[model samples]
Target: MFRRKTTEEVPAQTEPRPERPGSKGRPTPTRKEAEAAARERAKLAQDPKAMRKKQREMRVESSRQVRQALKSGDEKYLPARDQGPVRRFIRDFVDSRLGFTELLAPMLLLIIILGTGVLGENMRLFSSTLWIVTIILVILDIGWLRFRVRREVRARFPEESLKGVVWYAVMRAVNMRFLRLPKPQRKIGEALPERYR
Candidate 1:
């Protein structure tokens, strides 16, 4: 501590003061380079084939994320529904054709069954009814999974919208039920860069 000659006391200054740089300027990327980069991003977002490829990549990454979450004892993953073409059709089918999604359908089905029992000639119709129920449930299951994976991607990335419409369509195709099972195709681990894995 040091006593100021004119005032009171001033604390001892021991730390070295940091020096500020005198001249600093923003970096300037070449115009040609900037244009090239922009084009590359647009291609990634708009190219149908590239978009499909990214969707396949996303599927694999999603599976790995699930496996890792399970291994680490975290209950964080949940699914979200996108209003895209596939989801729209699936939701519509579930809503209109299958009574399994809305309570009204099940209730109506119950009513139909009771009415059929009373009517007495349409009991054979129950067989077809049961088959329809099974199909609806299967579709619902696939829709549910697709929604979940899409949700995980949204939560993990910064982009609210996907690259573009074409890419989105491609991704939707790649994430089809037939392609997305945990079979022995290329995996997230295999697809990722070595450093990321």
Candidate 2:
């Protein structure tokens, strides 16, 4: 039966509260555990001198690989301009043909020397002749390159952006074949498979 209680009387204590569950995340570590972990981390830390030496070796190896890739025209490691299959094809196509643009560098050198007024009165005629010839040949070569590359690129990659492709091809063509980087993959007059042509 319920007891009648005096002013000082108290109710019996309720059952002790149940323990709260721990969080799903890692629990807080004890002092000994924390100290042991700290010691392990210190032991595993690398020496600064050795770490630097290892990093330098890694960099040197990486650079060597990149150089080899560039020389061999490995698509995976090529610069952005030469990375894509379309660009590779463009390079090959430009390289495999002989075009007037191949004379661009030499012709430019001639123009520069002639324009310096060293030949006196003949300078004007010489400069004008060289300029005219350079312009005509370069234009003709670029036009032909654009037409051929556009056709082949369309055949091979119908969805590729034509934007900048013409310039890319023309620039490659303007340089002598041997001087071009990622040196020509195909021989002169060597054709791509019939589907690409």
Candidate 3:
């Protein structure tokens, strides 16, 4: 009765602990492997020429992708101006219609030839008249295109901004079909899809 009882102490664990969820599930890397990896990293860091060359190659590839995208009308690689469904719809709409502005380039060339007296002095008056007529037609065509594009854009994209859309459509309409960037997804008079994206 005079002797006090002692509490038993638990033994320290010797077995390996269970892996936690999301653990790597492998043994830690050895010192040699770690040293090798560090050395490789240092080697890459020290080689400025190789790094620069790699960067240049990447940029060239990126440029190539952008050019291809512009030609093919792929949305992922298109430039800022050509991106978005609204711009695409505008491009298709402009491309599908034959506008008088497309004739302006060839007419201007003819005017230049006539002005140079290569076609004879009598052609000069004709050239001036043609110039005036072409200008008037272009103005009328642009005005009509702006109105139609604005109306369609409003109907299709109710909440979208109309800021530069009319101008963008006009510019696209001004270019000859073959010369247009993102190259005319819709053919002349082809019905456009309900959605552009």
Scored by TM-score, the top model is 3
- TM-score, cand. 3: 0.77
- Name model 3 segments beyond 4 Å from true: 1-44
Instruction: Give the alpha carbon lDDT tens digit for every residue of 83-146 in model 3.
Output: 9999999999998899998888998999888878777888988888888999999999999999
Model 2 lDDT tens row, 128-150: 89899899988988898899899
lDDT of 1: 0.46
Better of 1 and 3 by TM-score: 3
Ranking by TM-score: 3, 2, 1
From the highest lDDT down, the ranking of the candidates is 3, 2, 1
lDDT of each: 0.46, 0.81, 0.89
lDDT at residue 52 of model 1 (Cα atoms):
87
Candidate 2: pairs in clash: none
TM-score of each: 0.23, 0.66, 0.77
Whole-model lDDT, model 3: 0.89
Which 10-residue window in model 3 sums to the lowest lDDT? 19-28
